[model samples]
Target: MSRKPSTSHFLLLLIIIITVAVSAARTSAQSTSLCPSSSVNPEFCPINCFRPDPVCGADNVTYTCGCDDALCAGVRVVKLGPCDA
Candidate 1:
């Protein structure tokens, strides 16, 4: 006779999936070491976080800005050098 999977097996599978997702998220956060800061301070936040625009920060580094403006935080813009171009 054929048998069906038990509820415990389903629960185990769900827990494993959740654990994998959380682990992946942590890995992503740690991988973004280039963005040392967040867009919490306007002083460092980009004036215009338009895509296809690059910003040279006070840290003496240039970054291609995302629409969210999280990459260029806690620094002033030196000039424009969009990454796409």
Candidate 2:
């Protein structure tokens, strides 16, 4: 016997896709609002203000190397150095 995709399966897939898309959009919007228009994501909005060890983030912001990559503010570490100006 051969089995085919069911309607429920399709609906579930669609729901998952929509959820993911919405989440991505929300994140994008947040980044735009937080970071400057010239930047991509709000990976570095200076929210992690502290002693500077010259660490750059994925969104082109600087942070201290002392701060762990797992920032509670949701910033992603790109490199352990000052961002290119």
Candidate 3:
């Protein structure tokens, strides 16, 4: 006969599964929302259009811009090169 899982074992398994699912969902959500909508062309408004916030890193600095929507907030990170006048 097969042995059934104990209560503690079942609870642990449940926790692990939930954690994995949540982590996966979070990662996918981040990837989607981290980039601005392609419909918004940056060429039209170069200076103030794509406002990016700076994030410091060990080797290079990164910039992130969030969508200031009425319901939800989203962010996009872009690498800034040399500034042109």
> Which lDDT value does model 3 have at 75?
30
What is each predicted model's overall lDDT from 0 to 1?
0.59, 0.61, 0.46
Ranking by lDDT: 2, 1, 3
For model 3, the local distance difference test gives: 0.46
Q: Name model 1 segments beyond 4 Å from true.
A: 35-85
lDDT of 1 by residue, 1-85 (tens): 9999999999999999999999999999777554334545556555564455556555666666632253435455544553332
The global Cα lDDT (0 to 1) of model 2 is 0.61
Worst 10 residues of 2 by lDDT: 33-42
> Which pairs of residues have clashing backbones in candidate 2?
none
Candidate 2 or 1, higher TM-score:
1
lDDT of 3 by residue, 1-85 (tens): 9998899998999999999999999998777543345454444433342555443222333323333221122233332331222
**Decreasing TM-score order of the candidates:** 1, 3, 2
lDDT score, candidate 1: 0.59
